[model samples]
Target: MPDLITPTTRLYRAWLDAHAEWGPGTHEDGFGLTSTDDVGSRAGFASWVRRLGDESARTTCRWIIEDRQVLGGIALRHHLDEYVRWAGHVGFGVRPSARGRGLAGWALGRMLDHARLLGIEQLLLVCAADNMASATTIQRQGGVLEGIRDTPLGPARRYWITLTPPIG
Candidate 1:
């Protein structure tokens, strides 16, 4: 798997910028939509690393796909029961130069593996009702559509994926 996942670091600045400029589309936007310009700075990126390292409360992780020479990332923001109900265990994005290569789907599958390790039984993945690609991705991961909700962005569809007992 080429260690397809890792912590976000200063070394990833170039990768981050590439994906950042790609911006948002589909029924969703970029993966790090909540991040500020400061968060994209070196110092700010360091702070983000520290927060993700907490491993308690809400844990976050950013993983890059190494096999493909593509700017892609997956982010898991834990404690979804609080700030997010429509969102799920993770959100991810693949740069415009890398779309249609199955990188998002691959990254999402890896995120689910990590979620299972964290003892998450079910994951809620939310996408814009018009995001066929995202909905297809979630469904490919065994997700079942729960319903839809009106949000500031637009109407979002919620899908739930149940992890098996083994969870491996």
Candidate 2:
């Protein structure tokens, strides 16, 4: 089973391996990595991890780990902002090697539980319109389509998932 963990410098090597597999881009959606984050050096990685820790009030970022290997990442934003409006309240990505094992669905379910704890009654998620796998994953979790919108990244499907309170 894969577990979600807070980003830490101790997993630097593992994280780098995953990052490299994504092959040079700022599009690793769930990791909260920006173009400016320098994660290439030890000090830089430590600082990056600290920054993620500092952003706890506004967001929750978790790494998907299995057997001590970084498999992917998932993030949930606590509140809406301009970026969140475009990117959605939640985002996730699984490494290429980890794609077919249902990890995204698992991570998303976990994040929805976290959202409920934070009092967020619903969440918005967007994915490239052609991403059938992601659309299917969200649909499996009760996501309702809200139509596709053309954005800087091209047409993207928007979905909303309402959270039902846990049973006693």
Candidate 3:
């Protein structure tokens, strides 16, 4: 199993390549990366990395890696942001070339274990309604769909993974 680690600028090039393979406009907020250059790719991403431990921000970003190859990004947001309550406790993306290999399902299952240890009783996740691949990944990890909900980004599928079982 690949370990989720603190972003190291050393892996920036490999990370860039992996994401680039995912194609343009695939950037997500939790990605913690931007176009690579001598400019601010290192500086900006380094700044983002510095905030991973900020409890008040309620967000954490980590890269999934094994054998020094960057596979993808996975993040866990401890609490819902103001825009959408059911948005997600987690968000993840795998390299386009790395898709369809169960990478997402594996990453999610790892994040769920992390969430449970943190006492996150009910974890929510949302995916664009048109993203069939993501929907499949979520279901594979035991996400129970709660129907689709409207958002600023248009309709999104909402799912909740119960972290702690009900009182027995």
Candidate 4:
């Protein structure tokens, strides 16, 4: 895979707009909004991109698939305390048009590499109980289920994926 990660830029705004429309289905009430655009407005997204640029947090990265379009993105939120208990180290969303193309697994594998670079020995990944796809992605990356939690949104499954030292 070519560099799936890139700095978020104006060039990606159109892709972001399209990603925003991939919402949760009626049966899956716990999936949350499927797109980051729903989390904020255009300006907010821009601001988020800026924050992600900060080296200290290394907060964001865009994942482009074979087409070189922003197929998805992974957000790494650092400096968590209580939130870490339930919140995962990374949050990800694959564009609606690009779902089920194995991008989530690919992007997650890249994120794990990035997390290792950031000195994170372990990672927490949370997914809605009903989101079998998300759970599979985490499992494919070697995540171990920790437990489940009841959030205001609904019940979420928490998994921990540890980065093991290379064997000689």
Model 3: residues >4 Å from true position, as ranges?
A: 24-26, 29-40, 53-57, 84-86, 165-168
lDDT for 28 in candidate 4 is 18
lDDT, candidate 2, 1-168, per-residue tens: 889999988899999999999988668879998888888889988988999999999999999999889999999999878887778999999999989999999999999999988889888999999999999989988899999998789999999999987655
Q: TM-score, each model?
A: 0.79, 0.96, 0.82, 0.75
Off by over 4 Å in 4: 1-3, 23-45, 55-58, 65-68, 166-168
| lDDT of prediction 2 | 0.91
How many clashes does the backbone of model 3 have? Answer: 0
Cα RMSD (angstroms) for every candidate in the order listed: 3.4, 1.0, 3.5, 4.7
Question: Candidate 3 residues 48-163, lDDT tens each?
Answer: 55555454256667777877888888888887666338557788888777678787788888788877766778878889999999899888888899999888778999987787
Residue 36's lDDT in candidate 4: 46
Candidate order by decreasing lDDT: 2, 3, 1, 4
Clashing pairs in 2: none
**Candidate 1 lDDT over residue span 52-166, tens digit each:** 5664356555555555443566667666675468566677766676678777787788778878777778888888899898889889989899999987778999998898755
Candidate closest to the true structure, highest TM-score: 2
True-structure lDDT of candidate 1: 0.66
Native-to-model Cα distance after best TM-score fit, residue 159 in candidate 3, in Å: 0.5
Looking at model 4, which ten-residue stretch has the lowest summed lDDT?
25-34
TM-score ranking from best candidate downward: 2, 3, 1, 4
